[model samples]
Target: MQNERATDTQAALGTDTAPAGIYIHVPFCRAKCPYCDFYSVTDSDRIPNFVDALLKELKRRRGRVPSADTVYFGGGTPSILTPGQIERILGAVHDAFNMMPDSEVTLEVNPGTVSLDSLHGFRNAGINRLNIGLQSTNDRTLGFLGRIHTAEQARNTYRWARQAGFDNVGLDLIYGIPGQSREAWRAELADVTRLKSEHLSCYTLTLEPGTPLADRVNQGRIPSPDEAVVGDLFVFTCKWLDDHGYRQYEISNFARQDPGKGIDLRSRHNRKYWNFVPYLGFGPAAHSFLDQCRWWNHRNLAAYLADVAAGRLPVAEKERLTRDQQLIEAIYLGLRQTDGIDTVDFRQRFAIDFFDYFRKAMVPLIDGGLIQLASRRVRLTAQGMRLLEHVADVFIQALE
Candidate 1:
């Protein structure tokens, strides 16, 4: 169901030439979460300075990018900024890039950082979509994740977002916490379905080596769930959300199933990356890609600000993708989506018959019921979805 619509959507994207997306990373948090690995600082004092730097950076890169149809304000907590600040940053973007009429302007808001009025102000500032991080519906689990707001606060925030006239909202949830019970995981899915948000991103909890969560597990202060149980949670969550009105688009993302309504549930900005459409990234530590050449800004706030103030791009590293590299990436990205790889489209783009190229290896996977090959499209089966990493590895080796 999602596959047909998504394929058509992807095709239609070329009609307008697909305006590129811009990712504005607001890298500040009230307090860092134990499991978060995103670059964020707690120095609220630097916000004023950082906001100015952001505008300068935006203006600096203005004419370099294509017209933008999506501007995503992802953050340490985008809601941490006042409406005036948000407006100023977006004002700079308007002065710089050509935003489409129906642009998907998304702001990632943490629970406690936004109030009713704050949400209203955000909407007025031209934010059409809200991606709220409602990590878990369980209070204890919320606290365990070092979240500032209780589950109730998250609920209220979602309510406020709706009341603020936001018809498009996305909720983010996580499963596979240290002691997360299967029943509790189901309950979280239940709560999310009840909200009936247009998009859902459910991720399994991972303990990065340097994160506090990983340290606790390594020190034996807390035990991470066994891998087998975590895998089960992943499969169950995917099936449960699909059973409800959410169909999996990406491995971790589901869009509300609405064929009649024709609702655009897929994240247009994120789709650009998966589809290899060009995008530009601003703010410290953010990355940008165009024509298969990718570069990222300095990760440190100080260096980023200094460079922008001095009228220079704070690019820390860059690389131009080889044809082989680009092909690998396209396959890697396509396999991560529920629609999987459209071999017909791949052949058109790369001028190679995808089926013949991978026939030897694909035969085994198909026999194992891990992948299904139609006339010109290949996708993972329900059981195959759980083992995507391994399946992708096989493709990567074949590409080599």
Candidate 2:
């Protein structure tokens, strides 16, 4: 079943739609993953100071933003904090902002750090959703990725999370690991699908520059998967989930469809990002966007803490997007999901016909089988999703 929430295109283009959200970044980890590049440090000693600073930041930013319908606690492992710490942060948010009664509150949990009691306590503390990092069910793969949890621990974590009363749980999985075979990918996908979580994020592993994994690949410690193999696996992954009854929403996101219950479990907080909804971000290295202005916090924890201690907004840099830049972002982001682009909405929002304006870019993409044009919407074909990076490049250059 399609999700009940309006597509980002409709909401952004439609009048009287104000989507505001809150994102809290927990920048601490027990140990940094070899593949992780997000601004997290392996220092838990300073969490108390960070939490105090965060609440102050929240209070300080009051009145500058609107009430939010969604709040997400993501990080280096939000589960690492005590339930009380989490509750305090959520409490500060409620005290400072006009949070909706049924706000979708999510907390990102890692397999090794959470327990049944803690999960239940988190629920009691007001988190209604859990996003667990279960990248693979293969112990070998887990080890390769520097994960502290075993395959069994990951499964147990899911069971415990369910028992702790989280109906909207999301499972994060990764494919396209170096030396990963189709059989391995199949096994991983099967392991997760059987768990029946409300949402699944099947992402292809990328060796982002400067990460340990990328450095290893550069030095021949491991061979990067062949591009063709990754491509075939991506197709297989999409078809496999679709065949299993998960609704593919964004490229990496799929919502479960339980015919018995008739529920659509798409992520509300995440939908805001692709939908161009406004959001406020706190803690070090987090980003916020609103009113065409996009800003990010300090990337270094020391800098972040110092600024908050001194009553500063810790923002490192911000930009106000021009109308032309917004147009470019719309095309790139619109094509990243199954919803594609709504031409009519685009015309209305930007006061220009997408087809007439982007004729040169759209026609070749349409002819090349990379994009499909409909009466009201234009979307990427299955082939296009596989080659999206290249397709995005074409659109980016079209702006030039």
Model 2 C-alpha lDDT per residue in residues 1-400, reported as the tens digit of each score? 1122333343344322465889999999988888888889888999999999999999998855656889999988889999999999999998988888989999999999988999999999999999999999999999999998999999999999999999889999888988889998998888889988999999888888999989999999899868999999988998999999898988889998888886668999998787677889999999998876789999999999999999899999999766666677788889998999888877777666667767798778889999998778888888899999888878767666
Cα lDDT, all candidates: 0.86, 0.87
CA RMSD of each candidate after superposition: 4.9, 4.9
TM-score of each: 0.95, 0.94
Give model 2's TM-score versus the native structure: 0.94
lDDT of 1 by residue, 1-400 (tens): 0111122233222313568899999999999999999889999899999998888888888867668899999978989999889999989999999888889999999998999999999999989999999998999999999999999999999999999999999999988887787898998889889999999999889888799999999999999767888889988988898889898989889999888987778999999889887788888899998866789999899999899888898899999766666667777888889889998787766666788788887988999998997767899987788888888888878776
**Clash pairs detected, candidate 2:** none
Model 2 stretches with alpha carbons more than 4 Å out: 1-17, 260-262
What TM-score does model 1 achieve against the real structure?
0.95
